[model samples]
Target: LPHRYPFLLIDRIIELDIPNLKVKALKNVTVNEEFFNGHFPEYPVMPGVLIIEAMAQAGAYLMIKKLKAEGADGDFTVLFAGIDSAKFRKPVRPGDQIIFEIEGLNIKKSMGKIKGVAKVDGQVVCEAVLMAALKKS
Candidate 1:
């Protein structure tokens, strides 16, 4: 979603409900990830920040897609506006697949807020409230 490899975290979108403003996306973790090299050489764990970024990206994607589906007239870019109540509940390692479940909390002409949960094996690993704004691309 407008993101290049290594920086783009979403691998696939499993479910989407644009009207409800909810989506479920996946990211497969692997040793090949560049962050694994220095995040922890001996005992690698996916960085918490990256997980949060993944959540934000998923939220942004949702905004972009919904706007497109609504036939927005201009080229718009979704930008991360804020993050709140971010929590890391567990460590993410290689072989783990993060299921990002995001629900829109509020959306407006320019700004939007969404709540996201990152899960691994049905257990939540991280959660946050993310905000974004629409801007000229």
Candidate 2:
């Protein structure tokens, strides 16, 4: 949610279950994507790290929303604290819609962990476990 254009990865939220700490989001990759230009001029494949970022964004969105519902202010920011078990299972190209499945692993006063998976056509493309910390401005 703190990301801006060319950085903001998640396009939309398709499903959100706060009580269960789950969130599903989407991102449509297009030929016009800025990364496509330099990532590869002849053949382009979405960078695996961006897919992980998308998943983390989705996860952070869930945490922020849940925090707000619990009476926390919207002024807090989510910062990536750690990433682990990241695996790239498939290549993502233009015109592909990435689906992010984020499940909350744990949440404390200012820290959280989320297990995230990025999928396309129902196949996993990338996945990772992310840790984040909430900072108030």
Candidate 3:
């Protein structure tokens, strides 16, 4: 995912369906997270932006995998171009495992749009429509 520890949000890819343009990924939040220390010392909560970022990563994975399956070869990087209709439904905390479901809405050339939903314990924590661009790196 081109991301390293502390910044990489996704822990695993549970599902990948290139034909369907969908992907599911997981992120395990822990008390040791660097953001928890400052987000709230008294009562820590996962930042909403990070949840969205997790979803974006999952979408990026889907796009990259799809591109590879199509035999397009390159060192590519996906960058967020925009986010729309983002909503935070619940607060995430340490020990919570987040599941990100991403479905491609549109993909043309180097640009793509996806609908992302973040869930914890089967309950939605956040949802957003993400736009991204793929560029050779």
Clashing residue pairs in candidate 3, if any? Answer: none
Residue 124 deviation, candidate 3, in Å? 0.5
Per-residue lDDT for 1-137 in model 1, tens only? 77888699999889889999998999999999999999899999999999999998888878877787787777777888888999999999999999999998886668889999999999999999998988867
Screening candidate 2 with a backbone cut-off below 3 angstroms (N, C-alpha, C), the clashing residue pairs are none
* Candidate 2 lDDT, 87-124, residue by residue in tens: 99999999999999999999765999999988899999
TM-score leaderboard ranking:
3, 2, 1
Worst 10 residues of 1 by lDDT: 68-77
Candidate 3 residue lDDT tens string, 1-137: 89888789999999999899999999999999999999999999999999998899999989888888888888789999999999999999999999999999997559989999999999999999999999978
lDDT of 2 at 128: 93
Counting clashing residue pairs in each candidate, in order, gives 0, 0, 0
Which of the predicted structures, 1 or 3, would earn the higher lDDT when compared with the native? 3
State how far residue 109 of model 2 sits from its true place (Å): 2.5
User: What's the residue-level lDDT of 131 in candidate 3?
Assistant: 99
Root-mean-square deviation of candidate 2: 1.0
TM-score (all chains, Cα) for each model = 0.95, 0.96, 0.98
Best by lDDT: 3
